[model samples]
Target: MAGMPSAHSSGDSRAPGTERDGGTWVVIPLFNESSVIAGVIEGLLEVVEHVVCVDDGSTDGSAEIAEAAGARVVRHPYNLGQGAALQTGIGYAREQPGAEFIVTFDADGQHRVVDALAMVALAREEDAAIVFGSRFLDDRTRPGLLKKAVLKTAVWVTNLTTGLTLTDAHNGLRVIRIDAARAVNLKQDRMAHATEIVLQLGRTGLPYREFPVEVLYTEYSRAKGQSLLNSINILVDLVIN
Candidate 1:
């Protein structure tokens, strides 16, 4: 709804049947989200034709659930960090027959399907190489105070390092065109890859836009919120790599 020039009802269960239907593939880096993985994939399938879940050694049967939910499942032998899982998913998605765009979505159910669809539409309409979903673009997403502070810190670090002023850098909802997706080479193997992704995509000199998105902070998401220690570790990872 943010970048959409025309009115859109995102609640429509029918796939928009647009250029994005088969051309857009969602890459979700999943690790031990068995309880919500099925619903996440199911919701994605309602909007897009391709959904790829990279199971990062999830022992909780997440891979099976995702496959059963109609997603193409790629398994990791062990618990690689989020960055590795993303690299796997993106690589897998890019190889698909008709993949024109690769969307990086969170497996925690915080990311909304409607937002992803809108971002994809925005990319096609503007001929953008990348469309980043930013919660800070609008007041729709309300993270907790501490969470907000932590995210702001991440944004600061990302902007400072990447030379691109993005409102939300750690947001896991991003629509990257195949050309831009090809530019992604994440090696941090953890949360620090978020910053690295922005830097790499920026180096491509491609057209990009930030779309407003609402991240639903349910109890489940809040329970797995980013802590100060984790933030510090991500910073350390960035510094080291």
Candidate 2:
């Protein structure tokens, strides 16, 4: 919080028309994540004032669960992928009157809630436009050998293409300044949009930082989607697009 203005305590009193400060809204893009969205929203509510959940055409009850958990819900007509879902949620966040920062989180239960708060603090203290969660910062939490090889190749290619040195390029947890986010025009609609985001950030020369984050590989995440083959698909998308 070095560069940011001091935040008022949650119980501090202020004028009726004064703006409230501290943590900003969190945007979680989910697709058929009924089993975990509630917990994600609840965990975030403890630290943030607003939580927006974008339901990317999930036939399941993910939207209902998010709404029930006290999150603002936005529903897409079809499954538009994580990038589009995030874009939709970001649009909603920009419209909020007092939202100063935007934090993008995953709905698959991969990102930890505590790390998200840490990312926010880093964003404020460092005055970064974007703050990403880097799982590779700690060697103990690294992925399997094959997975690591694929990600390393992907990171190398991303660096070559975007000219940005990033240790982990696929992490979903990120915090961004509202102004910097407003300047970005994310057009990718599928999984490849993850890489697209970084490329855009690099092209724009936005200030960004990477922070250590924990990874949770769960049975439900494995069952839901995101196979090893998806890496190939992402590369194909990157090449063709």
Candidate 3:
């Protein structure tokens, strides 16, 4: 694999010969998700054999668990935000031989492999560069009233500012074409990266689409997910930065 950009301060190692045996490479930016990393990797492996878990300075041994589950683990020396983690993973995946597609999935186990595969198919069918998964398109996994309202407002603000009409702007589940993934650059290091991606995609004029997907909000994710204030912060970040 080619050396990662200087932005990756440390922890960019690949398993010997693992990069050559690739198909659909799923890039999962992992934080301290030790409780769920194993299961998440296992579930992802069921659909796609090549799964890259970028462990973003996880103190809870998330890298070990992911590696044990048959995933190619890329460790970060310290805690970078999810956006940075994602960029690291994507860069690593791009270096792999026979890297066909890239999928950005959540480490919290909220995203589904079925939905990801569907998005991949749709990206190929529509000839789109990127395909975003929209929870608002389906009623299977519903957010709470306040959470729904805040996220909806986020979509509105993002569309108004970036001129990209999307139903769910902050959804993490997305399938990006390998060629298009090379052009995708994320600047925002935090929650705001979601909006940054949309804006960047728009500016680059990449063919993109939204697909209906389920986001299972379990009690754990609800407790660990973004708060109301975080939504406002993301909006502010988009406006100023």
Q: Which predicted model would earn the best TM-score?
A: 1
For TM-score, candidate 1 versus 3, the one ahead is 1
Give the backbone clash total of model 2. 0
| lDDT tens per residue, model 2, 1-241 | 3124423222323344634334487889989888888888877776666788999999988999888887788899889888899889988876666667888898988788889888888888998989988888887565778878877877888778888888887778888888777765667777887888788777767798999998787777657646778988888887885
Worst 10 residues of 1 by lDDT: 1-10
List TM-scores for all candidates, in order.
0.91, 0.87, 0.88
Quote the lDDT for 206 in model 1.
Answer: 98
**How many residue pairs clash in model 3?**
0
lDDT, model 1, position 165:
83
**Steric clashes per prediction:** 0, 0, 0
List model 3 lDDT by residue over 1-241, tens digit each: 2232222212324444443323578999999889987888777766665788999999988898888887888888899899999999999987777677899999999998889989988987889988989999879878999988998988998898789889998899988878778876887888999888777777767888999999989888888999898987776777785
lDDT of each: 0.86, 0.79, 0.82
Better of 2 and 3 by lDDT: 3
**Residue pairs in candidate 2 whose N, alpha carbon or C atoms collide under 3 angstroms:** none
Q: Please write out the lDDT profile of model 1 over residues 1-241, one tens digit for every residue.
A: 1222212222333554543366788999999999999899888887677788899999989999888887888899999899999999999877666578899999999999999999998999999999999999989888878888889989998998888889997889999999899999999898888999999999999999999999999999888766677988998888984
**Model 3 spans > 4 angstroms off:** 1-22
For residue 48, what is the lDDT in candidate 1?
73
Ranking by TM-score: 1, 3, 2
Please give the distance, in angstroms, between residue 144's alpha carbon in candidate 1 and its true position after superposition.
1.6
Worst 10 residues of 2 by lDDT: 1-10
TM-score of candidate 3 relative to the true fold: 0.88
